[model samples]
Target: MKDKINELLERVENFRPKAVAEIEDFRVRILGRKGELTALMEEFKSVAPELKREFGQKLNELKRRAQERVAALRAEAEQAAGEASSQIADMSRPGSEEELGSRHPISLVRNQIVEVFARLGYTVADGPEIEDDWHVFSALNFPPEHPARDMQDTFFIGKNPDVLLRTHTSSIQVRTMERQQPPIRVICPGRVFRNEAISYRAHCIFHQIEGLYIDEGVSFADMKQSILYFAKEIFGEETTIRMRPSYFPFTEPSAEVDVSCNLCGGKGCNVCKGTGWLEIMGCGMVDPNVLEACGIDSKRYSGFAFGMGVERIAMLKYGVRDLRLYFENDVRFLRQFESAL
Candidate 1:
């Protein structure tokens, strides 16, 4: 029994498990029910009383050492397994997908509009949002008594009221004509300001893209062809346009341009107010008074001018009813346009 006790004690001190499973199995063999230590405990009862004290001590020491060694070896084995797994992993593999960002819907539509006109020899023109009455109204044939000159319709900057926010990109066209001579072809795209009430269809601040073309022999026919081509290109090849006689301060024989409702296929709907048409822009032959005001010879050079609201175009193209959506900066609303190029 003494030899047995010494042998088991040496086994406990020398035991080293090659794997975590081996450590658990070793524990069961040494300390579990019906195992070596359990069997030895049963045998200890049969020993002489004087030897029982020494054997019992040795048995208890062996059991404690066995448990300690099994636990230590199991922990070491598990740590080694974890290290091996890490080393074997492929770090070069792609990680979890990261979401990509996109341009704002308004920007995307603006760029598209510019690209469309760019192909037709129209260079982009820009001007300051702030302007004097001359460039914004006077040079554009806006009479002093025009309602647009009133504070109710326009944003005045100071007590003098001459300095104000431009109500249209036509100021850019006026600036262009002042610097350049005839044969001028430019498209003005910019932000404009007004004093209108905020609503789903109207805003105090908005964007406009107005086009001007002045050269010899330019006529109303040329304007019609050009606008027709633009309507077709923007709303789809099947789109058609009609010019209803209208009025504007800067243009003679002004007409409000309407395109067949692309949404309802011209059959009439709530969007088009069941009219089977959607008002898109205004167009006319540049009023001679406007040309002379900008230093161009009204007699030698005849041209056409057209203007449209960028928000209105976007609303039609994207089917967004509320004009407020363009300005809200809501992430959820913006995320929907992520797929738009």
Candidate 2:
């Protein structure tokens, strides 16, 4: 029995496992219930009384050595695993590119439009999405019974007709006039809400950029030239513009502004519906009544205001057929504008 104990001690001291699984197997074979160490402990009870002390001491030392060997083998196996994992990676090679996010299509076009106007000395302006009727309609020469004031066209807050979501960014122009004196040149850009059904071309919510230039001796010609410069900058150098007489509550001698079709060099295309033209915005001289309502002296000052839908501009520029794409947060659709940024 003493010789068997000495042999087992030598085995424990030399024990080494190449892997974590072998280390666990070694532990179960020697130290587990019904294992070698447990069997040896049982055998000690049959030893003679005089020999018990010496055998007991040997058994305790063997058990201690077996436990220490198992622990060392486990640590070595873990270290080997870590080294193997580290070798799987190429430390000297270039790293994989981290994916970069991009600006939304609407934002890209909006920024481009703002940049074009910024070059012309027009400062950007903003206003609240929720507004009172006066800033949106009343102060803009909208009559009390105007159809736009109705709940069917405008989104009223709660039961109050006077407070509602702005149907257009023209509200910001009114706010600007109310606070600033003439010689005011500002471009209002923001989101507007309407009580309308959503569709590929139309939505309940949209963006608009409205420009206002008020000062002594401002004229329709100045507005036309300014718009022409903007059209050429946005579309191309050869682009041309033609205004058709139209009507708006806030602009006298109003006209809808259209640019020659860029898709077909103004010849014809399905995008322009074969008309060789595409309407872009609305513009005209500011109505005296509108100017007077906002505390601007109509007799002393005159101005022109023009407004265009930002989503519409984005669609024209990017050839996007669906207005809904701008509002949907689809990463695949938005990623198309990464290069545009």
Q: Which stretches of candidate 1 lie over 4 Å from their true place?
A: 1-94
Relative to the true structure, how large is the alpha-carbon lDDT of every model?
0.91, 0.92
- Per-candidate TM equals 0.74, 0.74
**Predicted candidate 1 versus true structure: per-residue lDDT over 1-341, tens digit per residue:** 88888898898889877656887788889898978889889989999999988898888888888888987887888899899988777778888798979888878878888888888889999999999999999999888899999999999987878899999999999999999998999999999999999999999999999999999999999999988988898899999999999999999989999999998999999999999999999999999999999899999999999999999999998899999999999988889898888
Candidate 1 vs. true structure, TM-score: 0.74
Q: lDDT of candidate 1?
A: 0.91
**lDDT per residue as tens, model 2, 43-133:** 9999999999999999999999999888878777788879987887777789889888898888888899899999989999999999998
Top candidate on lDDT is: 2
